[model samples]
Target chain A: MKRIFKIYTPFINAGMQETATYRVNWVFYILGSVLGCFVSYFIWHAVFLSGSGETMNGFSLPQMIVYIFLIFLTSTMIGSDAAWAVGEEVRDGSIAMRLIKPVSYNATFLFQELGNKLLTEMFLVVPLIAGLEIVRTVIVGRVEFSVVNLLIYLCSCVLAYLINFFFNICFGFLAFVIKYLWGANMMKNCIVGFLSGAIIPLSFLPETLGRIFMLLPFASLNYTPVMIYMGVYQGTELLYYIGLQVFWALFFFGLSKLLWVVSVRRLSVQGG
Target chain B: MKHIRRLFRIHRIFVVQELKRMMEYKGDFIVGVIGFLMVQCSNLLFLWIIFNNIPNLLGWSLNEVVFIYGFSLIPKGIDHLFFDNLWAIGHFTVRKGDFDKYLTRPVNTLVHVLFEKLQIDALGELIMGIALVCVSLPQLQIEWSVFKVLLGIAAVFFATFIFTGIKIITASVAFWKKRSGNIIYMVYMFNDFAKYPVTIYNEVIKNLITYIIPFAFTAYFPALYLLTGENPLYNVGMTVLMSLALMSLGVFVWHRGIRAYESAGS
Candidate 1:
């Protein structure tokens, strides 16, 4: 583990600096997210108005509002352009040059994506959450967030990040065979956006479907952490959720390692 | 008259060239359509999920809300299909000095820029919009007439121009800033607000959409007008006025931006 960390630390640093170079995009990124926040607010506000002035399923209006912001926060952490980057590199044959480098490709991408996520969390997501929370408080009355829940939420997020990154690398590896992941990438995002509970809370779904989704790895992405943040899980239940994240994290990482080996062999460049 | 005719003739030639290029990537096109269709379906699913819990959104029924949602997509899809090349300007055309190609051409630069490519992925949104409208029209139960049908068609046609006008104005910022993709994105995403009933928004946001960005006229107003027979002058008429105003502003900006443009030193 130390050896792997030693190998990838510089790459992670490089990735962080590379992302920081595009800091002009930071303002617009924040602005775009504000719109998303408003959309959530309006939609949920309307839903609450239309229904009985009480909690739907288990989430109160305030909880749902907070859930939306937490979704934004978690999505920011889990989201990475590394897969899209990999697809582009693979398509353009840049991966061929990287192949000769005496390091692990998947590990390099894994850490680099971590670096990107860290930078975004620092410069964009964290600050936006602070701002959104104030707005969230003013609009929907403050819902208590316990310290224990926040800590567990952060821990679950780390595990979720691993699961998300490995899944992306595995998905990106498809380009080595298919040569373009544009459509596949879109399909992946569209599906993930909903399934990861970014679109709406999974608990809002029918009970059976909700239970089934919790078993799926995608739940570890945004749903678990947000649920934890909302204090929906505690004690043994919280530990179980964390265990699920750990299990999926390991599963996806293994899947990515296997795919990486095959992908390197399958890599082919079209035209000079 | 002759200049307009020449530009139209040239646009046709460019479009034909684009169609031929599109033919080379049949697989990409199909996958893109399917992918976008799925994307739209997911949004539809969100609305469906919400409605499952409740019967209406701001007194707008599921079908009525879906009607606006679907109506919003049509103008968006139209702009996406034809004017997507404009995205390049805001994204990288100015930064990469690709805009020079437009200037060096014999044809008008704006015309050349616009006619350069046709984005096929937008067909999914177009097809989804049409399908949604057709499916929901029966459920909506609006008093229909030949005049209303023709008026709706005109409203939709003008709405497409509103999208193009906004895109053009936003994209022209690249000439001055070298990269205005983010600005364009921030402005363009306001259209999402337009997809829902504007009444759901607070007074501030309602005014913001109607006056500043004018996206309210794109879908919500026209949909409201069509369904409820509200002020024709305010709804459809404002749509026409906004489109014309935006188009003029777009053209004016493009010209001003062209003068200010400085290519990257190669």
Candidate 2:
């Protein structure tokens, strides 16, 4: 493990440098996300205001706003362009270079992604959340935050990140056979955007659909952590949610490993 | 007249070449279409889910909202189909110093660049948009008349110009920034706000969409004029005026950008 860390640390540093080089781009990305959150907040605010009741599916206007805010935070941590990077490399026949490396390709990629994620969390997510918290306090008053819930939310967020990474890598492996993954990437984004509750809360979905989404791994992506932070699930239910996240993380990781093997074999057969 | 005819001929040739190239990668083409369709379907599904819970959003029924959503796509699809190469300006061409090629070309640089590539995926959006409009037309209970048909066509035509104009202005920012894709993307995200009734939003958002960015002229205003048949002249007039204003601004910016252009590599 120490040796692996030693090998990957430089790559992570390189990734951090690359991210720093595009600091202006990150500014625009964060700005766009903030604008998106405002738009969503206003839309839901209108809906709640239009209705007779202040709550929709047990989400008050402020809670919904907070939920959107949390979704953006978790999304920044979990969302990685690793799939697109991998897809490009595979399409261009550059995966062979990585395959020839002494280090495991997945480990190098994961470490680099982790480095980028760490930078983004610090520079983008943390500051944005702080700003939003200030706004929330000014507008909606005090928000409930417990140490136990925060700890569990953090753990669930880590699991969500892993699940997302493995899912992206799985899609990246498809580039071995499919020359263009742009379409597949778009479709995957749409599916994940809806099923993962990034665009809308899963609870707002029809009951059967919401239940189905809960069963799927995608629900853990943004929904589970945000819900946990909201204290929607507690006690044994919270434990079960955490367990489900772990199960998905392990499942996707194994599936991606199997896919990598098959894809590498295919590449070798094709003289890649 | 002669220059316009020549430009049209060149555009046709470029489009034909793009189509041939797209056909070479049939799988990619099909997948692109499917991907766009999936995105459109998901958006419609979102609307369905929302409407299932609420009977109306600001007095707009499900069918009415769907009509607006569908109408919004026509202009967006047209812009995507033809002007997608503008994205390359912000993303690659300016950054890589490839804008020099457009300057050297014999044809009008803007025309040549705009027609350089066609996004076939937009055909999927076009099909879906028309299908949605058709499915909702009967339910909308609006009397089909020759004038209304002409008005709708005009609305779509002007809306496409508005979309293209915005894209051009955004892409032209590459002259100053060298890489302005993110800015372009951020600005483009405002189009999402235009998909619903403008009345649903607060005064600030409404004015922002109407006067500042003017996306409401692309969808909501036209749909309002078409559906309710109230203030038809005002809505359609604003659409036309906005289209002309935006297009002129786009051309003006493009010229300024060309003058400001310094190739990337020294």
Candidate 3:
């Protein structure tokens, strides 16, 4: 464990330094996201006002508001764009330098992501969540989140992050073939944003469509974590969703490992 | 007249150069168009899902909402198609000292920058907008006449300038800051607010879109005028007036930024 820790520390430090250099990006990213949140808020508020039901899709107006904000918070914590980073290294032929190093390229990024998130969460993300919680409290008339759910929510977030990171790492492997992944990246973001219920809850979608999406692992990324936080799933049901997250995380991990070996072999053969 | 003709001739030359360059990246272009199409499709899916839960939003039917959404895209896509290179100026041109090349050119600098690239990927947005407007047309309650048609066309044409103007003003900030893509992104994204019924929002946001950024004049106001025939002078006229004001402001800022441009120091 000590040796493992030592191996990852430098990459983590490098990631934090890289992120620190782009402090301005963090601000504008949050601003754009907050604007998206407000747009969702007003649209949903309008929907509630027009509808006769007190609850639609099993969420009250207050719960729906919390759901929207929590989606933003959780997705920010868990979402990965490792594909873009990996694709860039490949494009500039810097992957060869990375390969020569003793470190595991994919594993190092996890530590780097840790470093990136540590800085972001400690400074930007935590403060934003606190501010949102205050807004949520003002809107809902009380601070009502269960403390137990928060603990479990954190655990689920770990698995969700791993799942997302592996998925994007797989996309990064595509850089071996595609050369430019900009369009593919855009498509991935939209599809994931929709499927993961970051834009809207899956329950609000058509029942069959929602069910089909759940059959994939995207819902586990954002939806499952928020639902756990809201205490919508309990006991065995909660365990079931968390187990599903583990399954997807492992599946993507194996797939990415297979791709890494194949791609690296191809790389050496072509380089010679 | 001669100067304008010369500018057009130069613009044509640059466009041909860009088209030749585009042949090398045909696959990327196709993928970009498909990517945009998917985004629009998913957005419409989101809209559909919302309407599934509620009968109407802010007393406006889904078809009416769709009309406004589609109308907003026309101007946005037009601006995206022609002025995408503005993004590079905001993003890295000033930061990397590439702005020096534009200044040294003999042609009008602002015109030169704009004529440098044409992004064909926005064809997806343009086509989707026209498709949505047509799909929603039969259900809308608008009374169409030759005069109204002409007014609508003119409103959309001028509304395109609103997007271009906002992009220019924000992008020109790069001259001083070395990069202003985020500023442009922040301001340009306000157009999303106008894609829906502006009245559905809080008073503050409604006023923000209408007066502060004036993005509402690009879509909701013009759509509202056509749908309900309330006041063309207020809807269509304000759009034209705002476009004129914004463009003059845009050009003034670009010139000011030109004077301020210090190439990024090594």
Ordered from best to worst lDDT, the candidate numbers read: 3, 1, 2
Task: Please give the lDDT score at residue B15 for candidate 3.
Answer: 89
Instruction: Write the number of the candidate with greater DockQ, choosing between 2 and 3.
Output: 3
Which ranges of candidate 3 are over 4 A from the true structure? A268-272
The best candidate by lDDT is: 3
For model 2, residues A1-272, the per-residue Cα lDDT tens digits are 89878999998898898889888987886776677777777667767766777788888877888898899888878887778988988777777788888988888889988888778777765576567667767777675646676678878999999999988999898888788799889989989988989888888887898999999999988899999987899899998989999999999999999998888777742354
Question: Each candidate: what lDDT?
Answer: 0.86, 0.86, 0.88
Which residue pairs in model 1 clash with each other?
none
Collision pairs in model 3: none
Which residue pairs clash within candidate 2? Answer: none
Off by over 4 Å in 1: A1-6, A135-143, A270-272
Model 1 residue B169 distance off true place after TM-score fit, in angstroms: 1.4
Q: Which ten residues in a row have the lowest lDDT in candidate 1 chain B?
A: B144-153
Q: For residues A1-272, what per-residue lDDT tens digits would candidate 1 score against the true structure? A: 89878888998898789778777766686686668778778889889999975999888887788888888888877777768988989877888777889988877787777776677677765575567567667866664646677778888889888888888888888777674489879999988888888888898888999888889988889999998887888889988989999999999889988988776777666675
Give the CA lDDT, 0 to 100, for residue A81 in model 3: 69
